[model samples]
Target: MYHAIAQDIIKSIMADEYTTKLPTEKVLMQRFDASRNTIRKAIDVVFRHGLLRRVQGSGNFIIKQPANSGTILNLSIGFDRAAMVEGGPLVSQVVTFDKVQADDRLAGQGNIAVGTELYRVIRLRYLKGTLYDLEESYFPRTVVPFLSTDSVQHSIFAFLREAYDIYGSTTENYVHQVRLNDERAALIGVPVGDKTMCLDAINYLANGDVFNFSQTFFVYPDLELYYHTENIDLQK
Candidate 1:
């Protein structure tokens, strides 16, 4: 319920529903028919997104409009690839790990050659004892020659860095909102057709070779994401 309220409040803010400050807690509680705590929780979620600033005497004030691109300085809000090993009680359950050949489509996505050998891995992540997201990843066998259940149950990146001395140089991310399919929805304990987020990523090694391609589906309200951007003037 708080997630839904937070989503609505974010949408309203992006739509410019409020000019400077949000409604009082009493007003939001009455409008949402929720308790004061629930409303406060929802507001806190928004605040974490770098969208609002709470003034002690004043109400929640708009700090920045989230829809404005290239305006956010920094907002490191959600769990990401780096969070896997950053250590805050994260658990990973490996569902499937198999050696597979990359087909044309898979090759294109990973920027690898067709017929390339790859390790296809599917994992479910639990954050603080709750199902958080599902990740499907592929690693080129040439880059990652061996993988084990034990290694995957922890951090694959950490293993690569320690064992192979392979470090990530860059990553490209494509993110969008998506509705989960029946299988994914069931696996993540969400209703069918529930809205969530899909992040498609291509990761490169320090040697400038593509090493990993992955797609992750994040459960709503369980995940928060923030990106910092800066504007560059080409004519300057």
Candidate 2:
């Protein structure tokens, strides 16, 4: 029910129905015939999609949609989904896809037991024919056994959800501003020593097992991190 409400709200936003601020909670509850909790949940769904922002004393405000900017949706579903939300198709060029047994280093990084089999995948992500990001991911074969080249070209998450009914529940990301090496630089069409936003993430399944470990480099200049607010102090 909340998902349906969220879709309606998104549709309305796209149609310029709510351009500045959303209606009050009481007004929304009356309008949708939903409970306050459900309306709030729907608002959270829109917030995660980068469409709405909450002001403390003010009501929910609409965020101006960026012009051809690749948005990083806070949901952490997949890059393909994020691109789809921004009205563009995300293209992937698979660089490496192979099976390997996890060593001590890999196990520690992925929080999986040693000797577990994992598929190592490296891909260059493009938006509208321009290189946008690079991703190197490791997926446990126990969680994802048969990944095809077509899945690698498209979306791994979609393949998992459709094939195995597996979905991403959470992601723990470590953000860093790092300099690109010679090889990484050339792949993403950046100069060596160029600073890039890199995220190392451990993606988990609903059962709480680590499904994937990925390192992604954002080479795009207009990358936005909308999840983080301006006033909140990030802990060290």
Candidate 3:
């Protein structure tokens, strides 16, 4: 009975444009002839779902509708490839940008010689104000002649595609689940030993030449990863 009344109250507020204080407990008690415990329980339900936010010395306000409970999509394989599709806002804050020597791991991923000059870029990504993932990317200097912090701030993929005409499509992708270490946890603002998703992807050009490589760690329990394949009929 409380749930039914709560739902009606929520619906009424959502439908109306006027912003007014919710009726006091006394009014609600009279309207529904409900006990104090029942009224409190109804309010508690909405509060836990983020549909209501309480202000100090003020009444509860409807800040937003209840958020969708489940995993958000964490699309990685280089931002360029991911940006091709349209959905939600994709924002990235550059953490580090510098040139570095291609170590064994970097060389193997980019298919380049050790000690080759490579551009390293690190970014933290968010979805609707919630921290979602952290990414570290490496690019061959030969492919991207020059890069600047300002240019990347706008959109790294846009800068690459328009200025250098360097674009990458995913050739291979690897994903796994692992516990976050102290360093990684600190970077993502999560507790140490928290479960996370590790993704490694090798991106190649239209000609099959490797262009970029990346490793991304996503805050799990909030994001989900998926892959889909479809068969096409060439002959019609």
Candidate 4:
């Protein structure tokens, strides 16, 4: 019954009902002929679908829709799964995988000291053999001093977990469009005026320590982004 009510609300949303805010909980409970808990649960179902946002001191608001209405790209997933979901020929070519001294730029990005030893890994990602993303990651040597080319050729997240037992690191991502420079444009096979998106992420350990900083440049038109946020509280 709650699911039916939620679906009815979703249909109403499609019909342009409640564009900004949803009805009050008391009203919804009365309309649905359901208990407060049932209405709240139904609303939560819609909220998890990325449509509703509950603001403090305000009512539930309909969030703006993402670009990929047909497909929601989950950020919680890895590149290999997302890049080749359609079962096409996916490729990850390593451009540069070596240890380098962290310059001022790296130090600022990774929150490490200048002249710190870090492993810089750069790889070009493709979907169905068409290039679309350029991934570059920086890991402080103090964290993972040794990495193999084979390990990197597959999945860095897997390698980190299997080798270093690194798990449950918090990831922070920032998304924005950028105008590609001449060199990058040439490599990406796009003109200088073409636009690109940079997804910058920083991984941190459970103790709130920095682990790695990664930046992936994606072709805006060819790819999209999705993220799900959850609140973790131990108290009941």
Q: How many residue pairs clash in each candidate at the backbone level?
A: 0, 0, 0, 0
lDDT for each residue of candidate 3 in 128-225, tens digit (9 for 90 to 100): 56666788888777777788888766566667766876655445778888898897788898899988778877777767766677888876343544
The model with the greater lDDT, 2 or 3, is: 2
176: Cα error in model 3, Å: 0.8
Best by lDDT: 2
TM-score of predicted structure 3 = 0.60
Off by over 4 Å in 1: 1-87, 220-222, 230-236
Q: Which ten contiguous residues of candidate 3 have the minimum total lDDT? A: 77-86
Worst ten in a row by lDDT for model 1: 70-79
Give the Cα lDDT of each candidate.
Answer: 0.73, 0.76, 0.65, 0.70
**Residue pairs with backbone overlap in model 2:** none
In candidate 1, list every pair of residues with a backbone clash.
Answer: none
Output the better candidate (2/3) by TM-score. 2
User: Model 2, stretches more than 4 Å misplaced?
Assistant: 1-87, 189-191, 228-236
List where candidate 3 sits over 4 angstroms from the true fold: 1-87, 232-236
The candidate that achieves the highest TM-score relative to the unseen native structure: 2
Query: In lDDT terms, how accurate is model 2?
Result: 0.76
How many clashes does the backbone of model 1 have?
0
Candidate 2: give its CA RMSD in angstroms.
5.3
Residue 213 lDDT in candidate 1:
91
Instruction: For candidate 4, list the clashing residue pairs, or say none.
Output: none
lDDT of 1 by residue, 130-168 (tens): 666799999998888898888888878768766886655
**lDDT of residue 216 for candidate 1:** 85
